[model samples]
Target: MNKLNNYKDNEYEYYPICINGQIFNCFSSMSLKDLLLYLNFNLSLVIVEYNKQIIDKEDWSNICLNINDSVEVITITGGG
Candidate 1:
C-alpha cells in the first residue's frame, strides 16, 4: 500500500471569504449550505452571489475555489 497518495479532500483548506472589502477565514471543506449553517445564517434568505451571479446549492460544491478568489457572500437580512 502506498502511504503517499493524492486526494481531492486533502486539497481542501481554510480560505478567506472576501465580503465588500474585508477578509474573513472561517470554515473549510464546507459547501455553501454548510458554511451558512456554521454561521447561523438562514440559507434560504441569504445569497451566495459570486462571479456576478447567484450560485445554487447544486453548483456550490462544484464551485472550484482558487487562491485569492475575489468572492463576496451576501446575506439578505431584515431589520427594523
Candidate 2:
C-alpha cells in the first residue's frame, strides 16, 4: 500500500493512487468513470482493472476511488 497526503475540499477530497505502476494524486471522491474522464481516456477503447480485478463499465460509476488504490488501464488496438 502507498501513503497519501490527506486533503479536503468543500466539494471533494484529494489523495494518492497507483495507476499502471505510476503514482498520481487524485480526487478521493471521484469514481472510476470520473477518473477515466479526468485522464482523458477514450472510454470505449480501454479496459480497466481495479485492485487487480476487472471492472465492468456499468460499475465504473459506482466504484469510488480511495487512497493507495491500484488501477490498471489497457488500451485496445487492432492491427491487420
Candidate 3:
C-alpha cells in the first residue's frame, strides 16, 4: 500500500471516495466498520451500500475501502 507519513509521524493512506454524492478523503486501510466508526455512525440504525451494492452488517469488517469507491449511508427512521 502507498502510505503517507504526516508531520506527527503517523502513517496513513488516503483515497478519494464518494459518499452520498459528496467526495471525501478516506483512509485507504480502513474497513467499512472502521470507516463507519470514524464517521460516528450508529451501526444499528444505518444501512450501508458499497459500490452500489448493499453490504451485510456481518461483512462490514471484511470489506476494505479502495480509491474512487462509492458508499451510501441510509439511516433508518421510524415515525408516524
Candidate 4:
C-alpha cells in the first residue's frame, strides 16, 4: 500500500501510484473524477479501470484513490 509522506518541499504530501505501469506522484488524496480532470482526459470517451476492476462513470466521483493503487485509463478514438 502506498502511503503519503511529506516531501522536501514541505508544502505538499506526495503518494506513489501506478498508472498504466508508470509511477506517478500525486499530492494528497483525490477521487477518480479529480484524477481524470488532472490528466485532461475526455470523460465522455475514456474508460477507467481501477485496481483491475472496471469502474462505472457514475461512480467516479465516489471512488477515492489510495496510494499505490493501479489505474488503467483507455481513451476511445474515432477511426474508420
Best-fitting candidate, scored by lDDT: 2
- For 34-64, candidate 4 gives per-residue lDDT tens digits of 9889989999999999999999999999987
lDDT score of residue 69 within candidate 3: 82
Best by TM-score: 2
lDDT over C-alpha atoms for residue 3 of model 3: 36
Which run of 10 residues does model 2 get worst, by summed lDDT? 1-10
Show where candidate 1 strays beyond 4 Å: 1-13, 76-80
What's the lDDT for all of these models?
0.56, 0.90, 0.83, 0.82
Q: Write down the TM-score of every candidate.
A: 0.52, 0.87, 0.84, 0.83
- Candidate 1: worst-modelled 10 consecutive residues by lDDT: 1-10
Give lDDT tens digits, candidate 3, residues 1-80.
23333221267667777778887778778899998999999999999999989999999999988787889999999999
For model 4, name the residue pairs that clash. Answer: none
Give per-residue CA lDDT, model 1, range 12-77, as digits (tens): 556555544555454455555565567677666767766467788677667654334445567777
Q: Which of the two, 1 or 4, has more lDDT?
A: 4
What is the clash tally of candidate 4? 0
* TM-score of model 1 vs. true structure: 0.52
Residues 1-80, model 2: lDDT tens digits: 65767577798678889999998878777899999999999999999999999999999999999888999999999999
Off by over 4 Å in 2: 8-12
lDDT of 2 at 39: 95
* Model 4 regions more than 4 Å off: 1-9
